[model samples]
Target: MRPSTDIDPAIPLRARDGDVEAFAELVEFFHVRCLRYARYMLGEEEDAEEAVQDTFVRVYDHLGQFRPDARFEPWLFRILANRCRTVRERRRRRESLVTTGELPAVAAEAEGMSQDLLEEVEAALEELPAEQREAFLLRHVEDLSYEDMAVITGVRLSALRMRVKRACDTLRIRLKEER
Candidate 1:
């Protein structure tokens, strides 16, 4: 489930107006989630960190371009998602063998979730197609509306829905089998 991660509506507006402290607040508010999402996407801490840093840098560079009428969550996530894709592509082009993935630090965020269960779920998530996994994470884990997801992913609402559905179905089966 997604956390209640909202910030003040004025934060982005303040940041866009060249408020350095506001921008810092924006970074602080989103850093953990951006890192977590990037980690899930890249499956490595270093890559995730790079993606998140790049994402914030880009966001700062382009804050003036952000539409004031729009919500900040989707816009921030859109940049993060793009950064993940870029980092993933770069990693892929390097063609290096990666034998390990970082354990999710957010595992403790889920109260009452067992370590074994978290590992099983992470393994199952890793087995999903990238598109499906991204869709599932954006929709479920990030608690984004389908419309927001469409803006972030550039995928049609139906396609995003289908991807999330397939991911959930696969996860259900995989988790059940693991148990």
Candidate 2:
């Protein structure tokens, strides 16, 4: 489902114009959602935090490059997604040095969610390829439109639709087996 944020487009514009409070406002506005998305993308709290931190830093550094007429969410997500990829790559290289069986912690625990169900779902998610998981989270979790996802991911609309469909089908089957 879509997030509840009713963003004011001019905030980023103000930040682009070197307004310090506006920059902080931008960070405050998107921080939670960005953290959640980053957690899903990176699969760890620390990595997600780093990705979000790096994203805001990059956004702050390149505010002048932001297009005044553009939608801020997609642009911001584009940066965050790239940061996630970078962080994930680094983790892969590090994992080659050490091994662990621990699963990444959930970003946030929903009330009334059973531990068994959360574990099953997390295990299922970890099974999917990164592209499929990314597509699924972007489409279903973030509720971004295909056009926005296209911009954020640099993937074609048809391919994204296919990815989401595949992800849904896979999750449906995997979760069903748990019942």
Candidate 3:
């Protein structure tokens, strides 16, 4: 059965029931959005792309268990976030193992292209802790509400609010320092 919001309700239900065509339709609908979220969270383009693909696989495996009443995007996002966390943990382990090495460089053109406003915002966002960064990106960049963020991050609404607030404060401080 298609979710009510979907243009074609039958497709999702069919997909949920193991129809390949219906599943493919769902993939086409959500793929780009998932990739954008992955990119914003992971920061590495290649890693982000991998994360998106991983998310799709997980979603496919678990889709049969999804509640019909629940919204689809949050379920997908939870998978994405879990994948991102795994990638980040692996990176941390590698970082601890490595000796000193040249850090990844931002392209000169990227830096030159950014105005002060953009630079300050980007710098401040980079300063946030991972959870807070995810909260901020979901809330502002992706335009998700606090409730949706709570679902996506598997946090309570109050905790999501706090994370977003902390992210904002950190951004403000970093931006002020840049001025």
Q: Write the per-residue lDDT of candidate 2 for residues 95-129, one digit (tens) a residue.
A: 32121335434533555666687777767877788
Clashing pairs in 3: 1-13, 2-9
Model 3 quality (TM-score) = 0.76
- Cα deviation of 127 in candidate 1 (Å)? 1.0
Best by TM-score: 1
Model 1 scores worst on lDDT over the 10 consecutive residues at 94-103
Estimate the TM-score of every prediction: 0.89, 0.86, 0.76
Judge candidate 3 at residue 16 and give its lDDT.
Answer: 79
Instruction: State the displacement of the C-alpha of residue 34, model 2, in Å, after optimal TM-score superposition.
Output: 1.2
Tens digit per residue, CA lDDT, model 1, 1-179: 55556678899999999999999999898898888788778887888889999999999999989888888889999999999988888776633323255565565557667777877888888888889989999988878889999999999999999999999999999999988
Ranking by lDDT: 1, 2, 3
What overall lDDT, based on C-alpha atoms, would model 1 receive against the true structure?
Answer: 0.86
Once fitted onto the true fold, the runs of candidate 1 whose alpha carbons sit more than 4 angstroms away are: 1-4, 93-110
Clashing pairs in 1: none
Candidate 3, residue 21: CA error in Å? 2.9
- RMSD for all candidates, in order, please: 2.8, 3.7, 6.3
Instruction: Sort the predicted structures by TM-score, highest score first.
Output: 1, 2, 3
Model 2, which residues run further than 4 Å from truth? Answer: 1-6, 93-113
lDDT of 3 by residue, 16-124 (tens): 7898887888889877767767765666667777898888888888878877777776777788888998887776543222112232336434766445566456556
Poorly placed runs, candidate 3 (over 4 Å): 1-11, 93-116
Worst 10 residues of 2 by lDDT: 94-103
